[model samples]
Structures are given as structure tokens and as C-alpha cells.
Target: MQMEPIAIYLFVSALFILVILKIKTTNSSSKLPPGLWKLPIIGNLHQLAAGGPLIHKVLRDIAKKHGPLVHLQLGHVSTILVSSPEIAKQVMKTHDIVFASRSQPLSAKIISYDSANIGFAPYGDYWRQMRKICVLDLLSTKRVQSFRSLREEEFSGLATLLASHAGSPVNLTQMLHATMLGFTSRAAFGKKYQNQEKFISILCELLKVGTGFNIADFYPSIKWLQDITGLRTKLEKLHLEVDSLLDEIIDDHIADDNNNTSMHEDLVDVLLRVQNDRNYEITRNNIKAVILDMFAAGTDTSATTIDWTMAEMLKNPSALKKAQEEVRRVFSEKGYVDESNFDELKYLRAVIKETLRLHPPAPLLLPRLSRERCVIDGYEIPQKTQVLVNAWTIGRDSRYWEDAECFIAERFLDSSIDFNGNNFEYIPFGAGRRMCPGMSFGLANVELPLALFLYHFDWKLPNGMKHEDLDMSEVYFGVTVRRELNMHVIPIVSKPV
Candidate 1:
């Protein structure tokens, strides 16, 4: 019954030819970039539906025809898709502040404690305070370095398990994902909590709905439909459930009188200490939101990156042989691979970099919203417009790369290109003020397990499947690119030299 007015409005809007004409005339003079013809109210939403809901592939195809910078109207959301490195520089570097604030989606609002977390928080004082704490206390070099021993212990445990299953087909994806969770759980919430699996399952469910593109996000005017569509109700339940769980964890920490005197502090301890301090005004919700960000994002993305890296290497045999050889030769000589000497494994680093280039964990690298109307390269961008820099497309663009589609780790060996935000050509972790602060921690999650996986055993495709036959296809539903099929492989023990 409540949707009747919206239904009538939609019916009436479809026949408002005069309104469409007026918009066309205004847009003609305003110099909007080229995009597909839009329909009344729907505004290319139907077109995107017809083409397929995979916005990454849809936008990439549109950019191929309309040029690197293309305009789109996803419902009423004014969107600009940037597919080239040059335009990426303009958005990420030149006019970063103009596009710094995120357009908070409805799902984000429900799940992130109303965008209280750093990743989705609108650019402002609260975001600044939270980010500073994360950088200085949680994600600082000293903090990340402090977690080195913890990572080594987790990696060793995983490697031992894999070795026992040598000469058998194992679900590398499942194993790696579980181990990464344990690793992240320890770093963020002290030891692997008794409810790590429950927390992980709940978090994953929340992310699936939160990160997905909801109808409400496209047509926010009908935001009440978020409940109509059932997304909000589902998220609200999960939010309460997750909140209860986090509260228990924080309560346990509060009960620990010795936490203050302990030499090592987990992220939760640090946040609690700050909360108790008079210098910063924070609540328990803020602490939980921050830790949620640490868990969901810090674990999932690195695991996705590792999975894609393994898939890509499997598809390209020479790269796999080279990566495994480099890991084994470098680490075997030292009798073990640890953080202090891990830096010496240059090729492994390059493989990780190359993997980031081809398959960035967040392909669109987080959507940024235009704070005010601005012009970029003569195209007028209206305030509140969504700006998505296609990091995946940019990474594979031939203009900046030679043999761009092929997996070649050597390109990054002795090369200047890096994942840091400065170099526009490659921004797997993104750039500017909103660039991911957890890069160090995320990299540690990916790099250590990846090196161990290579060093501990030789991996092969199941059932005599040739490397060329392995599927490198991806799952690009929203922003992240995960493997479409599970990467099942048999692990063989590596012979000692």
C-alpha cells in the first residue's frame, strides 16, 4: 500500500516527454560526456539490466566505445566511469579532494554503524579522528611490525597441515581462506576467539549483501524499498547479531585488568585504551565498527588477491614455475622464510605486484562521490555524482602496458611501477586520502601465506588438467573480483635439492 504513490509516479514519469526534452536540452549545453540514451525515471537502469548487472564488464564495454571517460545514469545517480590511467590520475590526484567523500549506500549505512567506519565514512572530522587512530595505533608500521611473530606462527601451522596432505588434491581456496581468518582474527581480536568461525560466517554474509549493488543504491529516492526488497531487514538482524558478538569480545577485554600492563596490545586493546582516554571521545559502537572494518576488509581482500594470484599463475605455467622456484631457492637457502629476510625474495614480491595489477582485489577501488559540481577535461560533473575509477581496466590497458593480458611478473622486477597511490598506472590499493590504510597488514596477510604455499609443496591442476585449461575467469559482481570456480589443486611434496 505504501508503494502505491511511487508506482503512480513511475507510471506518470514514463509519459513525461517534456521533462525528457528539457533534460536533453540542458545536458546538450552542459557538456555531459557521451552515454547510452536513457529512459524516463529508469535512466539507463533498464539498459544495464539488459546488458547484464555486472557493472564492471558493462562499464568497460561502454568505455571502449565512448572513450575512456564515459557518463552514465544508474537510475538517478549521475555516474562517470573512468577506464584509462590518465583520467584516473585526474580523479585520484588532481581533484582528489573534490571527490574524497563516499556516497553512503543504504546497505553500508545499516552494516557500518551508519558509516562510522573509516572505509565508508563521509570525509569529515569523525573520519579523520578514526583514521588517525587506525594509522597511528592500529595500522602503523610499528603496530604491523609487532604482529610479525604472530603471522609467522599462523603461516607455519598452515604449511604443516598442507604438508601432511601432500600428494593429494586439496581445496587451496578453503584452506587459505580459513588460515587467513585465523591470522586476521589474532591480529585484530587477540587470539583466535572461540567464535571465530561464527564471526567469520556472519561477517561474510553481511559483506555479500553490503557490498552488492542494491536497487536502493541506484534509485535512492525509493530508499524505503530497501525494506521492501528485504535487504535492510536482513542486514539489521545481522548487525544486531554481530554487535552482540563484538560486545562480548570487548567485555572480555575490559575484564582483563592486565591488558594495560601487557607488552603487546591487540587492535581491540588499543581502541579500548583510546576510548578510556579523555583525549578522544569514542563509544563502544565505534570500537566495534572499527574492528569490523579490520576483520571484513583486512581478511577478505588479501585472500581474494592470493586466490587470484594462484589462479593466474596456474593459467600461465612459466610464471608459476618461476614463482615457485624463486620462493624455494630463496627460502630454502635460509632454512626458513621469515619477515626479516623475506624482503630478499624479489621475484615473489614482483609476482604479488603483478597479480595486484591484473586482478585488484577491489576492481573499482571503492566508489567516490563528487562533493560539488566540477569540470574534468571539459566534461561537467554534477555534485553528488558517483565516480568509479576502473582500476581493473586501467591495469590491463595496453597504452601503459606491453603484452597487457599476459601474466608476466618480470615486468615489475627492477621496475618503478608499484601499488602505492602515487603511481597512477597501478593502484590496487587505490590512492589519495581515502586510499586503503590497511595495505601493510593486508599485504602481510597475502605475502606470508603465498610464500609458504609455494615453498611447502608443488601444486598442480587436478586430473591431468593442463595449465592452459585452467579457468582464469573471475567473479566481478560488485567491486571485488574473486575466482568464479573453486581453485582445487593437488599438492605434491617438493624434492629437496
Candidate 2:
């Protein structure tokens, strides 16, 4: 019996090797883009791993050496790295529909309710319907506007908490995350749900696991590898935990009669109200998936953006002073900051633009899958090839910006460039059909809290450290990136003008 088992294993191993050889033979004929020479079986994974955990930075370095449009055989997967705006435009704009679908990683598939969510759903009618519902019902301009008071209330609590710890070192990272959590909870769940903290913890774990480089994702043909590596088991557990929590929330919403008639209908209420549409029927799992997408995308991205903006300003005091002066000059008379006069805060907006240019929440915007073989910049890209647009590299490209590496807010002062995806050179939110629909909603979350933080307090680095000494090292988590270390700063309440 033991000999029989060994014989079976040997046969399987031989089969796998033959399959890999066949794939290599087939790809050898294709005119793929230029890339570093890769080894058999492992492909360029060793090269990528050698460049460290910061995959975006590693890919940026590789692109600089090889070219902007580089191809790599990552295990069994064919991958494309786009570091230049022109190629990014070609892939995301000129040939957008051809590359509109997302690459479904194993983690995303398991955690996102089998890729049912808007973020990872396959490009089809289901995805289109879900996105439409999200835009029209949840993220519409009017709907986001309705949450203005909720934002103010959450920020007020944050400001009060900051005031209580004025002279002491405060973890701005944690505080900002908490504020966003509270705001998002009320907006999505109709109230500060009791399980909000638990949900946040689960989501954080999901992001960590989902974003981390998974070996199984690269080698999909090795089905048993996931089980051997225990990644599948971990993801299954996470999915169960998240599913249970979401089920409880949805059940509560279904049980609450008042939710149906409430003036301030939250996102859950909207989803529930629309679940039975004959033309676009949505299941309970689908509802949970969309809700998960909202929480995952809505909270972390906004909070991280605010966090990075603060760190960048603290490091560049001149830019910091200019931004503070502008905020105070505009809002000092009103004694509070709100969205009403946000249009006048030009320099502050510029500061935010600069921050995003340097530190996009998703350094490598969500990977796109080519629907069919297409020619990009004269290079033939294969069907189902995974595409990663290095927004971090494109943002800092010297061809676009003058002092590309510096934190200069003035560069955007008179410039017409914006991050709405029209200007391919600076796509913090991505572009094309797969572009984030919650741009306005996310910016609303970021701009208000950031403006309030500046208006109410003068910040100092903890332990008497100089601004230049502050650590701005970043850690990538899931679809977003944030400072590796929580920002510890002392807040000095500004005197009433």
C-alpha cells in the first residue's frame, strides 16, 4: 500500500512537470514584453522576493532597469508591470474594456464571498449590476452629502479626544482609524453597531492575509499546495468569522421594522430594500459581499490617506506651515471647519494632492486581468495576463512633475492636473471601468477630518524629535498601504483667534 501511494505521488509530480513545460513551450512563441531572465519553475519570484516585501518598490526598481512595460513569468502566471503613464493609459484607457476584469487571487475569492463583491467580481452583468447599485444607492453625491453631519460628529469626538491628550503623545494612526470606523459604521449600519470593533479587527486581519503574497496565487495548477501551506484553511476560517458577523448584522436589520421607515437610511437598509429586484436579484451572500467591500475600501483608504498626509506635512514643515496658514486663514473666522468653504482651501487641497502623489493608498492599484490577447505599445499581451499599474512610480515620474521626489504642494497650485483618472500621470484612484466609484465619498472622509485636524491643533513630533527625524516607513496591507509605525504626536490646541 505504501509503495502504491508513492507511485501515485510520482505520477502526479511528473504530470505537473509536463504541464509546466508545455506552458513554457507555448509562451516561448509569443512576443511578450521585455523582462529580466527568469528561472524554470520559480520564474521571477526569487528576483521579486530578493527585492523585499515592498513589492511596489521592487517592481519600480525592476521597471527602471528593464523598461516601463515589463513582463514576468511568475510561477504559472503571466504578469505585466506598467510603470509609465503612457502605457498605463494604453492598458487602462485605449484598451480598457479588454483589461477591465480583475485578477481573482485566492484570498480575494475566499474573503470576498467567492469574488461576488464589486472589487473582485468577474467582469460581467453581475459586476455591472452591483456597481450600478453601489453608485446609485450608496455612493451617489446626494447620499454622500447626507453623511456630512455624521462626519462632523465623528470628527468632533476625535477633536475632543485629542484635546484631552493635548500635551501627551497620541497615536494618531489608531485615533484616525477609530474615527473612520465610527463614521463608516454609522453610515453603513444606521448606528454605531455594537460589533464595530470586532468587525474592524476581522477586516484588518483579512486585509493582511489577502494582500500578502500567496504562493498558491502564483502556482494555481498546484491545487494541493494551498492545503499543504494552510493558506486555504486560514482564509476559510476568516471567511466564516466575517460571514457570521455580517449575517448577524443583516439579521438585525431584517428584524428591525424602524429601519425600513427611518429618514436616514444606511447602506444596509438600501441593500435590503433592493434585494428582491426581478431584473437584478441579489442573494444574502451578495449583500454581505458588497457591505464588506464598502467597509474594507471606505474606512482604511480614507484613514491611511489622512495618516500619510499628516506624516508628509510633518516632515516638510514649510509645506505644513503653508497648509496650516491657509486652513486657519479660511476657517478661523468661522471657528470650525466644514465642507461649505472647502472650495477656498486651495493650498490645503494642493497639499493633499502632493501627499497622494507620493503615497497613494494602493501603491499598486488593484491588479487587472486582460480579457483577451491585445497589443499594448506594440507588445503582445496574452489573454488573462495579470496587469499591475505602479501608480507610485507614475506619480513621481520626472517626465510629469518638476521636483518629482520632493513634497512640494505648490506644484499643484495652478496646475489643472487632478486625480479623477483623466490625467493618467497621477491616478491615485485608478482609471477606466474598474476605477473606484467611491472617490467622492472617500475624499469627503479624508478632506474633512484632515482640515479639522489642522484647524484645531498645532502638532509636534513625540519625544521632542525633529520633523525630519520622523519615520515615514510604510507597510502594505491588502489593497492599501499605511505607515509601518503608528504616528505618535503631541497636539497643542491652537488659541481661539
What TM-score against the true fold does each predicted structure earn? 0.92, 0.92
Report the Cα lDDT for residue 137, model 2.
80
Lowest lDDT 10-residue stretch of candidate 1: 255-264
- Angstrom error of the Cα, residue 153, model 2: value is 0.4
Collision count for each candidate, in order? 0, 0
Against the unseen true structure, what C-alpha lDDT does each candidate score? 0.83, 0.89
What TM-score would candidate 1 get against the native?
Answer: 0.92
Q: Write the per-residue lDDT of candidate 2 for residues 1-497, one digit (tens) a residue.
A: 76999999999999999999999887764578898888999899999999988888999999999899999889998999999999999988999999999988888788888899998999999999998987888788888888888888888888889998988999999999888888888888887667878887887787778768789888888899888988899889988988898898899989985845434788899888888566678999999988888888898899999999999999999888888888899987888888899999999899989999999999998889999999998889989999999999999999998889999989899999987899999999999999999999999998987888888889999777999898989887776889999989999999431
Cα lDDT tens digits for candidate 1, 99-169:
99998898778888888888999988898899898888889988888888999999889888878878788
Candidate 2 local distance difference test against the native: 0.89
